[model samples]
Target: MTLVLSACSYRYGRVRPYVLRAFSYELPDGLTILLGPNGAGKSTLLKLAAAVVVPQAGRVSYGNLSSRSKEFRREIAWMPQSITPLPSLTAREYVAYVGWLKGLSRTDAWERAQQALRRVELTEQEGVRTTQLSGGQIRRVGVAAALVHDARVLLLDEPTAGMDPRQRRLFRDVLAKLVEDGVQVLLSTHDVADLAEEADHVTVMDRGRVLLSGDTGAFLVEAPEGTAPGRVAEGAYTALLERGEQV
Candidate 1:
C-alpha cells in the first residue's frame, strides 16, 4: 500500500489559516522516516496520513484511493505519540480489543492478539495488566495492538519518544526486521541518530513545511574538517532547514 499526500494543507481554524499550508509527501513500501524538531508539523502530517484528521485541502490516499474507504481503514494501523490502554485490561486483551474494533471476529482477534504479542516480544507479559507494564513494554503493547489487525501500513508518531539509548537501538532493529517482512512503516522522530542506519528514505520538515525529501543519502551533509562523517542525519537536518531559510 502506498500513502501519498498531494498538496495537503491543514491548520486549526479561527487562529492560523495554515500551520501546514501545502505540504506534500509520498511514502513507499519500506521504513520511511519523518525527521523534524518538535512543533515542526510532524505529528500533523502523520495524523493526516492516518485518517485521524481530515486535511483542509488536497488529498491523502492509499493506492490512489481516499483513506476514508473502510477497506483502507481496516488495513491501516495508527499509533499516535502517546498511547493509553485501559488499566484493567490485560496486554493480550488490549491487543484483541483493537483487532475487534477493526472488524475482526472474536475468535480471529484473540488468535491474532497472541501472535501480535509474540512479534513484539511480549508473550511473557500478555497476561499482565497494561498499567503494570514498564513504559517501554506499554509502548510495545501499542505496537502489538496495531499489529493484531495484520495491518498493511503502520503510521507511528514518535515511537521511540521516551526510550533510552539501548531501547531506541532495539526498536530500530525491530523496524529493520519489519522491513524485511514487507511492512510499510511511516515513523516520525526528531532524533536523527535514530535513523542513522535504518531509514530507507527520509523527509525533513520544519515550521510546517517540507524542507527536503528523498533517499536517506540525498540529504546527508558532508562532515566538518575535524569530525567523522558518521551520523549525518544531524548535519542533514541543519543543512536542509538552514538552507530553506536562505531560499
Candidate 2:
C-alpha cells in the first residue's frame, strides 16, 4: 500500500497559505520517520494523511481509496499526539470499544482488545480505569487502541513521548515487529537517539516542504562524524524551524 500526496497545501483565514507543495513519495511497509522541528508542518502533513484536515489543494490517495473514503479510514490507524480516553471506561473496555468502531464483532473485539493490551505490555493493567493510569501508561492504552484493529498503516505522533528509556526500547521492539509483519508505519518523533538503528527511511520536513528524504544510512554518512546523531538530527530540526520562520 502507498500514500501519494500530490500538490497538497492548507490555508487558514487571513494568514498566507502554509505552502505544502507538490510532493509524492511511496511509503513502503516499514518504518518511515517524519523528522522536523516545531511548526515545520510535520503534524500538518500527518493530519493530511490521516484525512482529519482536508487539503486545500491537490489530493492524497491510499491504494484504491482516496483520503475521504471509508476504506481509507479502515486501512489506517492514527494515534494523535494527545489522546484522551473516556473517563469511565477501563483500558480493556476502551480498546474493545475502538475495535467495535472498527467493525469487529463483539467476541472478536474483546479478543483483539486482550491481544492489543498484550502487544503494548499493558495486559496486567487492562482492568485499570483510563483515568487512573499514568501518562506513559495512558499512552500505552492509546497505542493498544490504535493496534486493536490491525490496520495496515500506522501513523503515530510521538509514540514514546512520556515513556522511560526501557519503555521506549520496548516500543521500538513493537514497531520492529509491525514492520516485519508488513505494516507501514509513519511516525513523528523528537527522539532521534532511539531511531537511528530502527528507522529504515527518514523524511526531514522544513517549512511545509521536505528537505531530506532518503535511507537512514545515507543520512548518517552525510552527517558530521563525532557529532552525536541526536545533535545532527537536532541541527536539521533547528534548520527546519528557522525555515518555517522565514515563510
Candidate 3:
C-alpha cells in the first residue's frame, strides 16, 4: 500500500502568513528517506502522514483509503522525533504495551513484541529496563514499539539525530534488513550520510516545502563541483536553501 499525500499543507503558528506551502508525493515501498536541516518541515511531513495532525488543506491517503479512518490507524505506525519509553518497563514490556495499545490481545502483544525487538536487534536487551539502555538502544526500542503491530507504513522522525557513528551503522543495518523483509520505511533526518547508501528514494525539503524527490541511485553518483560523493546531498541541500527555494 503506497502512502500518498495530495496537496497537503500545515503550519506551526496560528498566523496565516506563517503557513507552510502545500506539497504532495506518492511514496513508494522500501526505505524512503526524507532529508533536511532543522526546521525544514521534514518532521511536519511525517506528522501529517501519521495523521497526528490534520492538514489545513488537502488529504493524506493510503492507496485509495483516506487517512482519517480507523483503518488508517490500524495500517500505519508512527514514531515521533521525541519518544519517551516507560522508564519502569523493560524493553520488551514497552514494546508489548505499544502493541496492546494498537489493538492486539495480551498474548499476541507479547509474541509480536518479541518479534519486533528481534527485527531491531534488541533481543538481548529484552529484559533490561529502558532507563538502563544506551541512547541508540532506546531509539531501537521506539522503533520496535512501532513495529509491534505489523503496520504497512512506518513513519519515523529524525530517529538517528544524536547517535554515534557505530550506533548509526547498526541502526541502518537493522533498517536494511526490514526493507529486505518488505516493510516500507519512511524516515526523516537532517543528516544524509546514511541515506547516500541505504535509501531507495530520497526526498529533500526545506522551510515547509519539498525541494526535490527522486531515486537514490542518482544521488549516489559522484557529485560534480569537486565535492566528496558522500557530501552530495549536503551540498545540494545548502544550495537549494541558498536559492531561496522556500522563501
lDDT of 3: 0.83
Candidate 1 or 2, higher TM-score? 1
RMSD of each: 1.7, 2.8, 2.0
Predicted candidate 2 versus true structure: per-residue lDDT over 157-237, tens digit per residue: 877777888777778887888788788889987556658545898887766777667777655555545667457755544
Report the C-alpha lDDT of model 1 over 1-247, residue by residue, as the tens digit: 5788889999987587577877778887788888888889999988888888899888888885797788777667799889896888999999999889889999999999999998878899999999898777888889888888887788889888888877777677777776787888889988888774468888888888878777776766432334446746676677677776787
Residue 81's lDDT in candidate 2:
95
- What Cα-based lDDT does every candidate model obtain? 0.82, 0.79, 0.83
Using all chains and alpha carbons, the TM-scores for the candidates as numbered come to 0.93, 0.87, 0.92
Instruction: Point to the candidate with the largest lDDT.
Output: 3
Segments of candidate 2 deviating more than 4 angstroms: 14-16, 225-247
